[model samples]
Target chain A: MNIPTLSELTARGETPEILFWVGCAGSYDDRYKRVTRAFAKILIAAEIKFAVLGPEESCTGDPARRAGNEFLFQMQAMNNIQILNGYGVKKIVTACPHCFNTLKNEYPELGGHYEVIHHSEFLQQLINEGRIKLTDTTAYKGKKITYHDSCYLGRANGVYEAPRAVIEALDADLAEMKRSKTRGLCCGAGGAQMFKDAEKGNKEINIERTEEALNTGAQTIAVACPFCMTMMTDGVKAKEKEQQIKVKDLAELIAEAQGLA
Target chain B: MIQQILFLLTLLGFAIILRKRIVQISRTIRLGRDVKIDGPTSRRFRNMLLVAFGQKKMFSRFIPAFFHFLIYIGFLVINIEALEFIIDGLAGTHRIFAPYLGGFYTVLMNVFEFLAVAVLVACVVFLIRRNVLKLPRFWSAEMTAWPRLDANIILITEIVLMLAILKMNAADQILQHREPQHYPSTGKLMFSSILIPVLEGYSTSFLIFVERFAWWFHIIGILAFAVYITYSKHLHIFMAFPNTWFARLQPAGYISNMPVVTREVKSMLGLPIEEPGTNEPPGRFGAKDVNDLPWTSLMAAYACTECGRCTSECPANITGKKLSPRKIMMDTRDRLEEVGRNLQNGGNGLDDGKSLLDHYITREEINACTSCNACVEACPVLINPLEIILELRRYVVMEESGAPASWNAMFQNLETNFAPWKFSAADRFNWAKD
Candidate 1:
């Protein structure tokens, strides 16, 4: 499969429909890289004209700002805004809730305005438009799948329904964890918590959240955010249930169900 | 006439004290940095109605919400009777409204009596929940001695006040029978009439004394409670309205940008600055003390009811981490009180070598937050403890450069490589290479 970068598209004198923001985690984390590919595959299958910023896409400075380094955060934000505004980017979609949140909500103030949509919402839109069709009798058919709400996506942005709708489109039983949606527990990796070890606590936050997910007796834990993907995968491993249950992103699940993976 | 004069003096004295206390609180809140909180007025008014007056968020916990609603309605409705007390005290008349309203007055007294009983029951249950059941929320580390005592004192005081009103009503009913000239019949009240059996067989003079004593005690207790609210967490009763009205309307994840840093960065990048060249000195990067936070945040600190709802919902606190969101608000309020006291004593404010940072809250507590917004979502009054955490973190990282070593490395990687990890930006598209 051939994927075009924004620079390549610009040189070819063509503009794609949406700029796919492959966040720091999506680009660098080995496990999350697969999610990036799976989501890209879905976009290709749907014939959506999407291009990536690739090397030109810097961090959205979500971590910097969250960690209280405003000077560094603004420096990075201003740099990204210059590149994005120069490209005349009008729309952005990302698999990372942090990037989606910063670009959609925080960027307009810094003058990088764009309609930012999380990948889950984008996927739901694709399915709703019948752009991507799933094959019958897929791996998740009649199976119980639980979706973990990323704090940035759930309570932070109030985008709770789009991801759930995407999950339901798979013809699978969507079992909800005890704490989901507004009261959903964090995966223990926000506010730059992903970069540093957790402070002294009785138990890890991801483990607690995983316990809630496991209590639902679901066979798969579906996530939308790459950060939650890493944390929940670690949690499933910690509980020694990696073999019995699998942690998959919503895009990966839809891609596999569509026979595109 | 002498009784009327004495009542007027007491009322005037307490009103002055209450006004002074409120003024002091407002002044302390004003010490915080001013930030414009412009938003749709209708939306803010709607938020106040739903969250504060409507008690919408409280209903999340049914049992407690039910009891709290009882007390809240009781406080509002019973105050009507307190208004009558003031009037009767001023005119030296008995049941002044009773002559005009007649049957409706009995209905109003019966409703007030019913609410008094409800308040009495709710307060007892809350006292038991705190002391006997020992709900974990009320016993968190920050609850300490005084907080626990403060909660108990208020609950017990409410119970005592309710009983005093009932006793006064019963004595009045008995005096109406014996000395109709002084205590004219206002019809039998429902819940208070239940106490008639307890007050029966008492002499007319004795009954009048009981009536007068209970009346004085109940009114004085209410006056004291009003003054006490300004100093206690119960300030939420009044502050919740304004706090909810001025709550942050943006998504919970949106940490407000530091415009000062924005201007500096714009100049460095050669981007046209929005407002160039101000005469004011550059302020500290973030909050080191209460005065550094926005006035809304400081007001939120004063408005916190110390219910531990935020703490109970906090992931860090739930996991046994040092960061209790309740403690953050409590400490902010405590530090603000200290500064207020310092200013009142004619000493330098915020210069006593004490601050909200290490003095009350610690670096460890602030670092533990995941910025999950659980506490913000859990807050019944729209308090954002995460905002406070973020402000303090800005102070630590930018002003003090005291982030943990790992975070510093992450910041370094973000600076050079444009990511948190030490990977080349060139490798960003390698994920698409299969």
Candidate 2:
């Protein structure tokens, strides 16, 4: 269960191949913390040399920027970039699409440049590299699992296939919602909505999106973003179908299938 | 000779009006801040070809797209015959290309006839869809009186124009039969020939009058439409090409970084700035009006055809939130026009005590956006309403610090604790302890 931080690795004059950016949501959201642990477990099982920023890692300012507070966003971005640069980190992987998008696309201009990959793509890479192996008969074999495309991961960046590929590797039935991929519905937590009440609407966007997932007849709704995990889970509960359908992160599913959980 | 003089004068009048409109629209769009959209000319060209010329995105909805394709192709192909009309009017000749093109002229005329019929049918179907069937998109809150009437007027105008082409051809066919020397046989055009039976009973002189009247009507109608489009949402006909060409090629999710804010942040942090600082006073932190937006954004405002596809696909609008992306574009265009007229009347531009933010688009609407880029993705012409929303939101938060109270707390937490929540950074990896 031991996890190494970048500082610990650096104190020993060592560097991990990749830095696991446990985003604010991944770090604190109780439900999403399990996803963080699950992804960490998969990395350990695959023997990938990675370390978390832990106490040093700060929010990537995705929320602040999205909330239209550029000053706070840049301030946080600059501090994080300085820390990442000081650690000489060259590559990053995270379970949060928000962090993945900001660190990958938005940071280079702010002087933080690194090869950033979402955990979905990273998991697909691991499975492709034969680093992570699933048992022949896994927990989700032939089970209906629908992956909700996080707006950040799917339309924002174009990483639609990797998460589905990871789901396919579970030997599960991938039921796509009517609106998915490039046309994917937002889980309603984007644009800093997660931190605030939704402006009054007929229904919560997550409920609307979850209805699509439910209509797909998928027993399990899979997600890559922590925000989607929270929203979809709340949606399933709101629909009173939590007992019938479960929402799990891609990493959690992979970790379970690999018996690393 | 008298007819030729009248035709030239009419043409000159319409051309002057169209030119004036084009110049005014160009100036209004230039009122926006200049953004350097450079390099990668090849990609931009491909985008314009596929989105504008190819009508690729229209196919997303099969039925409407099929009918729209009819009108789009019909309009472009029929313009070829208008070229002939212009040449004939200039030289005082009837069917001038008939001798040179010979049988091919008949074939070309037949194709134009067929397209005219198609355009007529499509316009009728569009009219029915708008008024009869009442598609929700065409009747959104922003689609008040003028927009709804404007749509119907364009469709009805197209129908009239298409009919004129058929009537002109049908009368010309009869004239050719009676007076071969003056009328010269161009052969029977398919769709228009159906009208020959009805017109066969008319007197020869009356038939000539009908042909002349129809010709003038068709030509004048097209000229009027060309000028009318600059004032209508139909501006998409010409603006789509330029708008799609200059579309933000970056991924839909990439909100452009403000270099001005970046430099200021670097200075505040005591970090060495890379680019030299400007001595000129920093402009407003974000867009408060159309003048504060990038020129591409303003062009997008003019380019939007108010199809409501963006609004229909919008998550906020779908859930009955007041945020309609289509309304955002329409409001922007309206505000820009107001500003343009204000400036023209010698009033201060963007300082007429009316701004695009609260005056046109309300804070409630812009704040309702999920910033999911659904509107951006749904746009067939690549208009990013999300970009406009973000810009306005930036203005609200940066310039006025007018964010909702809860958001202010989130910002404070992000500033102090490095996360939206007040949780300490030390506990970041507490889950690992398990």
Candidate 3:
């Protein structure tokens, strides 16, 4: 749970336009952490007054909601609401669909409402708004990037193009997984599935989804959800082909191209 | 002739009354919460084509399935023949011997009678499986509301018609008209020749009376079944179409947004659901009774063929936890009727303005749901019990109050710690930490 204090929000006053929700996924892994940190820097350079929601932000209770435990969901919803209000926050941007879904959909069910945005959608808006420019074109070696859409973000929220637009902005080759967009396969992590042991099904859902990514001949896999990033990265390691392919969250990819070390 | 005509007219009028009652029952039951399923739509359509038309999802057992498929298809196709029989009989064509048939008609009647007997035999086994063995758990409970004498009536009716058809076939050939010496049907009922001569030497009035008796019984028995089929859970005959059409369009794990939160006002002790007024009342988070459900949820009850597919696939029922997905749908239908009757007069009949749990859903039954959505996946008609369970959980948590202590603590932990685990909220990203 990474949260911001009210004093910081109040100090910025009616002017801070962005609140970077460096989600559980972005904060957990080092490479992703560095990349998201760079994402913050890019937004700051783009003149977006963004503050990190650190430590006070908690899990989005998506697992509880999926597990049919509404008590737990309401608890998380009310808590997030209080914290967001304490910061006097009106807008939020996050990378994980799990968090995005909880904040966007589940919160209202608990009596709190806030304007929420996914990081890809935010980046697309920034680029469209001419916020940041890529320093170089065709810089990275071609690694046919394949994107895995998170279920909550794609099917649940209907946010499709912004992520694609970000990938296209890279001028890199893009291939699609067998299941993507609205029909995206569950990474076996939705509905508190991340908390419970995988039930009976041929092929772990996340691994099966990853194989679809690998089938695209993409050496690198990019993800929007922190759970997906972690799951796919773990999947890549399990096949012992870690030395050959790499997993990157969207922000890290943007940061790498920005020449950030 | 007067008694038979009066009996037929009386039965026809009775059928109209029964039809009206069943439709009213259907409307009342289909009035609860909205249920959404994520199952594939094309699969449901494809399956119905195979099952209802091809009789596909029926028992895998060979003999019964064969018999049932024949009976099912025979009843459907042979409907035309029954209409012809009724029209001819009503026109005063009560013949003492073969009247309409020119030899060929006799053989066709023989074949039709043979098929009808085969279907009836198959139906007897179905009755045994349901009543004697109690193989389908819901079937026995479902039987309570149906006419108790149905099984006996169906059996007696089929046997009598079969014998009468056999008698008429052979009698027409010997006493009335003779031709087609090498016919296939004549050999099967060849024994009827012994009885035909005894009748042949009799007066014409006696023969005409016997023929009228057989005609009346066959026509009346089948039409009664048609009306009965619409009145009961066996109403699946008519309801299966719209029921299946409403089934979840994807897989079971798919969830459509829920419609309401239901709570028994008597049992509910927590958040007061602001009555629907100037403010948008906080949406109902769970279901407390049949009335709490959307109209579509009630429609799901009617659509259920009482196939018990949901119960058979339910992991909860397998472990003896006492939650039958089949029973949930059946119970909803039953409760709807019971409750609807109570409310039909515009008063809370069973509740007395009290909580419905004392009579409706048991606590243990409520807890047994895994929310696995298996029942939804297995159901061809697409009733989502998971949504109902979750909505019930919401009512319990927010209003009726008290839940499993483990869930309670986890709910608290969910507030401060991002995970249900007691870990600090800041650690939500810990899994991603290398």
Give the Cα error of residue B72 in candidate 3, in Å: 1.9
Q: Under CAPRI classification, how is model 2 graded?
A: high
Per-residue lDDT tens digits of candidate 3, residues A1-261?
Answer: 223333466775643676777665466555556556666666756767667656666666666665555545555555667677777777888877767777776566445577989988888887788776766545544658888877667756677778878877778788888656744555656545455445443355556667778899888888887667767877887777688788876766676666552
lDDT of 3 by residue, B1-434 (tens): 67658656856786787777676676586566444444577877776676555655454436556766777665675565666665555554433123445465556555576576676677677667766876755353433544335544554555565566555554544534332332223333444555676677756556555655665666676666667655455666666666665554532433333323212221133544544333446554566766666666677676666666666655455444566666666666767777666666777754765433435566556565544454664554456665555555555655665555655665666656565666666564453233
Task: Give candidate 2 regions above 4 Å deviation.
Answer: none
Ranking by DockQ: 1, 2, 3
Per-residue lDDT of A1-261 in model 1, one digit per residue for the tens? 588999999999999999999899999999999999999999999999989998888899999899889988899999999999999999999999999999989999999899999999999999999998998536888899999999999999999999999989988999999889999999999999999999998999999999999999999999998889989999999999999999999999999989988
Q: Tell me the interface RMSD of model 3, in angstroms.
A: 7.7
- lDDT (tens digit, per residue) of candidate 1 on B1-434: 99899999999999999999988899999999888787789999999999999999998889999999999999999998999999999999888998899899999999998999999999999999999999999999999999998898899999999999999999998888888887767898988888898889888888888989999999999999999988898889999999999999889989998888888999998989987767799888899999999999999998999999999988888899999999999999999999999999999988999999999999999999999999999999999999999999999999989999889999999999999899988887788776
* Pairs of residues clashing in candidate 1: none
- On DockQ, the leading prediction is 1
Which of 1 and 2 is the better model by lDDT?
A: 1
Give stretches of model 3 more than 4 Å off.
A1-63, A66-261, B1-8, B33-56, B59-67, B94-111, B128-207, B258-283, B343-358, B432-434
Total clashing pairs for each candidate: 0, 0, 38
